[model samples]
Target: MEFLQPTSWTDALAAKAASPEAVPICGGTDLMVELNFDARRPAALLDLTKVADLAQWDIDDGSVRLGAGVSYARIITELSARLPGLAMAARTVGSPQIRNRGTVGGNLGTASPAGDAHPPLLAAAATVEAASVRGTRLIGIDEFFTGVKRNALAADELIAAVRIPLPVGPEQFSKIGTRNAMVIAVAAFAVALQPARKLVRTGIGSAAPTPRRAPAAEQFLAGALAEHDLWESRAELPGPLLDRFGDLVTAAAAPIDDVRGTAAYRLHALGVMARRTLAWAWRQYQSASPEGS
Candidate 1:
């Protein structure tokens, strides 16, 4: 019913503390949908779009910090070169208009199990920065999402930014949907290689109640690569490893039969996307490697 746009963090926090129940709106991409359907209505809204400091972005000590108000359009255009997985996910989020208006904070705030950004952020092992009148706190992505459409944010808190540590190797992301674009993902995957440590982390979305790492698949791949000396050898990934990895990923998903997709279809698509993203990351890793020792 009432809107309060704050130009500074202090002002924002003051407004939030004043109205504890007031919804903090940044992009309004997800909240607008709920508002349109009359599913959510707050007595007041603390609009952070005009908060200048909340739109800042910077990279330090190999980690990138994106302001909560940063749009997908800026991410795709400005950060694509260094953070391809994030940019890829950002590109698939919604239409150009939506991307221009949507903020990463909104995506995290919504905390949908199938949100496009979650898998990539999970694979990147990102951290979220939240602030209130009291102080700031950094929470890991793994601990952020509590359940379906649920989060750990306090009523007086506002997401300040998202921080992602740089990967030591190539990363790739892919999603499966009924259509090419502008559709919700049935299954999404993000894979990253940490060659320095001979480690690989994979994140899967839409298949589980929350985006999570495919630990079994990751351990399996690590063992397979080591067995073939692929960790140090230039040998290509074995076909069996690929197949087994896909199967393991598929098994890890806890999908349900929903109107958007059948459980069986989601399971099938999880494997497909995993294989494709892994293969893509492997190729990029190989290409980035030096000519020879």
Candidate 2:
């Protein structure tokens, strides 16, 4: 296979437009495996490491624009405070070496249902920045995934960055795996409490065809919190409300029996994680004073 290395963003875009079949490679964490296993043999490999724009990140307005090539390690160290839920999820990605190389952009590109980054991104309501010689456009995280191992990216477009809004309150992420590190998730869940907007968003992974937000659960919990003035009172989350929220999260999934786990186990794990994460996030929200919030 041919390898093309472009040092500038413009050059990269030109190269991609010229060779639509060329696969872009940043960390190569996922793409290398596919190549090694003969699972994919693309016409060309577009090496993006030298493209400086794709490896940088900055906060713009009220959002953090994370470049596609930024490593998991950077997210943990540099962005932890701003993007806690993503940092927490990043910590669980493979090992130290893998974390040093793997990236959220790669996770989105792979579009794996079990990808650790997806849940947090979904929960954070992140957006994917897609670019080409034609122009650039933003794809909502909810609409980015098309199917198992599929995404909405056009043939000529490359993921430029992910834009995640600054957190308004607490966020939490949890996953069930055979082992603590380096193992794929059996199921994963994330919750973010956006008190300023009176929103409670959730994300579920490994229990669905695509990483997805628990909209029904979010609506139920948000409405419940509003009904009780819990958002302002910082009241303890009611057990029954938490239970119903978990049930709704479980209901959103459409898992199947696979080598890693059974559908029933995934469903059970999702419910447990949902309740636990929501509880943890709520406690964090409660502990912070309104000014701190």
Candidate 3:
């Protein structure tokens, strides 16, 4: 196999155009595992790790743009305080070694339904940017994942960066798994409270074929909390409405009995996480709000 390291986007695109079948690599976190197991061996590799432009990240006008090569370490240490839910998700990914080498774009490229970043990005209403020799295109997070381990990316395209709209209120992430750290999640949840609009959005992972929203639960919460001005209203979410919400979320999930966990466990835990994280985020939202407001 041949490796081509290109420094510029144009050079990278030219290389891809010349050999359309060449595999593109940034952080080898996922690809390397396949390579080690002899699961895949591309005839050529277009290495984008050295590409300067694809590594740039910035925030502008309540939007965060992260380069394809941005590591989880940078996200946890640098972006945590700004985007707590995303940072929390990043921290839960892998060990120090995996975190150091893994890239957000790699997670998207792999398109695993259980990817740690997907739930947070889905809740944040993120968008992905991709470029090819032909042109550039933007895809919403909702439209990005097509199925389990599948995506809509074209064969000759590369993910440039991901752009997320900033949150208007407090957000948090939680997961349930067999082990504390470095273990794949049985169920993961992300909740964001948009107080200004009286809206609450929730994203679920691991329980579904694709990361998805708890629309019924969100609608229930929206109505339940609309009349209340204090975070104390969260205490009321664990009643019949919560039970129905759990059932709806579980029904939305397309889980199978895998080695990591049972379908029942995933369903039960997803409900619990949804309830707890919503309360947690509500409390945080109250704390951040001004006193006597």
Candidate of highest TM-score:
2
Tens-digit lDDT string for candidate 3 (1-293): 99988999999988988888888888898998899999999999889989987777899778889888889988888888677788899999989888888888999999887889988888888899988999999999989999889888988888988997777788889988788788888889898877777777777888888888878777877776765544444344446655665676666677878988998888888878876787677667656644321
Question: Candidate 2, residues 1-293: lDDT per residue as tens digits?
Answer: 89999999999999999999999998999999999999999989999999999889999989999999999999999999999999999999999999999988899999999999999999999999999999999999999999999999999999999999999899999989999989899999999999989998888999989999989999999999999999999988889999999999999999999999999999999999999999999899989989888
Looking at model 2, the pairs that clash are: none
| TM-score for all models, in order of appearance | 0.96, 0.99, 0.93
For candidate 3, give the lDDT: 0.82
Superposition TM-score, candidate 1 onto the true structure: 0.96
Q: Where does model 1 exceed 4 Å of error?
A: 291-293
RMSD to truth, every model: 1.6, 0.7, 2.2
What range of 10 consecutive residues in model 1 has the weakest lDDT sum? Answer: 284-293
TM-score comparison, 2 vs 3, better candidate: 2
Query: Which number leads on lDDT?
Result: 2
In candidate 2, stretches whose alpha carbon ends up further than 4 angstroms from where it belongs are none
Model 2 clashes, total count: 0
User: CA lDDT of 176 in candidate 2?
Assistant: 91
Q: Give the Cα lDDT of each candidate.
A: 0.87, 0.94, 0.82
